[model samples]
Target: MNYILSIMPSLFAGAKMTLILFFWTLITAIPLGIIVSLGLLSYFKPLRLVLKFYIWIMRGTPLLLQLIFIFYGLPIVGIIFQRYDAALFAFILNYTAYFAEIFRGGFQSIPIGQYESARVLRLNYWQTLTHIIIPQVSKIVIPSIGNEVINLVKDTSLVYVIGLGELLRAGNVATARDVTLIPLVIVGIIYLLMTGIASFLLKKIERNFAKWK
Candidate 1:
C-alpha cells in the first residue's frame, strides 16, 4: 500500500538502531557475564561475595530506572556519557548481571566428580576449567543465552527513553505528525522479522552445541 511505502524508510532506520543496540549489547555482555560468573565461582570469599552482590543489585533494579540513573544521575558524579553510549553502558551492565547468573547456573550443573577426574589427570585449575568445565557449561548455558539474546532484541525499543532514536522513537515521531499508523505497524514487523531470524540462528547454535553432549 502507499501508506506502508511512505513510512518504510523511517521504519528501516529504526530497525538499524535496534540491531545496533541488540548486537552490541550481546557482543559486550556475554564476555563480561562470563567474567562475573567466574568471579562468583571463585574460591576467594571477598571476590565471590562482591560479585554476588553486584549481580543481585543489577537483577533487582528495573532496567529503565538503571538507564535513567546512568544517563541523568551519573553526570552529577562527573561521569558523563552521550545518551546512546549511556544507554549502551546501562544495558551491558544490566545484561551482564543476568547472563552471569545464567552462566553460573550452567557451571554449577557440572558434577564435582568431573573436577576430581581432571585433578587425577594432572590438569591444573585453568586447564580443567578450559577443557572440561567450559565445554559442558556451554551446552547448559546456550539455551539461556539464546533466550537473553532474543530479549535484548525486544529491549532495544526501551532505549528510546534515552533519546536513542530507535524504532519505537521513530514510530512516535510518525504518530505525532498524524501520518498513517503504518509506521508503528512496520516497526512491529521489523522487530518480528529480526527476532525470527535471531531465533533461527540461536536454535542452530543450540543444536550444534547439543551434539557435543
Candidate 2:
C-alpha cells in the first residue's frame, strides 16, 4: 500500500497521455468513420471499390504495424512527426477503418422499406440520411460503438511502443526504477476508472435509445 502511493504520480502522468490519446482518437475517428461509411455507401462503383480496398487494407493490418510505418517508414519520405503525434496519426487511421465498418453494418441493418417510405415523402438523399437513417443507425450501433470506445481506452497504452510514455510505459518505468509492482496496479486502476466512466455514459445513451423501442 505504501509502495502504491509512491508510484501513483508516475502512473497518473502516464494516464494523462493515455486519456489525451484516447479522447482525440475518438473525436477524430467518429467523424472520419461517418465519412468513410458514406463513401462505402456511395453509388459510384469506382469510388466504392477504391474505398472498399482502402478500408480492407487498413482493417486487415495490425495497428502496431501501422504505427511503426507511420513513425519510422514516413521518415524515409521526409514526413517526420514527433513520436506522440505519429502514434496519434496511426491510431486515428486504424480506428477510423474499424468504426466505418461498424457504421456501415448499422446502416445496412436498416430496412429497405424505410428508404422507400422516405423516398415516397419526397425527401432528398441527404435529408433522408440525416433524419431517417443516421438516428436509427446511431441507436442500433450504440452497443458496438461503446465497445470500441472501451477498447480505445486500453489501446492508448499501445502508443507507448512509439515512445509516448503512456500509462503502461509509465508503469514499466516506475517498476524498473522503484522495484515495485505497484505501478502496474496503479495503471490498471486508472484504466478501470476511465473505462467505468465511459461505460456509465454509454449506458445512459443506451437507455435513451431504448426509450424509442
Candidate maximizing lDDT: 2
| Residue range with the least summed lDDT across 10 consecutive positions in model 1 | 178-187
Q: In candidate 2, what are the lDDT values of residues 121-150, reduced to their tens digit?
A: 999999999999999999999999999999
User: What CA root-mean-square deviation does each model show from the true structure?
Assistant: 1.4, 1.4
- Give the per-residue lDDT of model 1 (tens digit) for 1-213: 886677778877888888888888999999899888988888899999888888888989889899989998899999999988998999999999999999999889999999999999999999998898988998888888988888899888888888888888988888778666767777788888999999999899888886665
* Per-prediction TM-score to the true structure, in the order listed: 0.94, 0.94
Q: lDDT of each model, Cα atoms only?
A: 0.88, 0.89
lDDT of 1: 0.88
After TM-score superposition, what is the CA distance of residue 78 in candidate 1 from its true location, in Å? 2.3
Q: What is the Cα-based TM-score of model 1?
A: 0.94
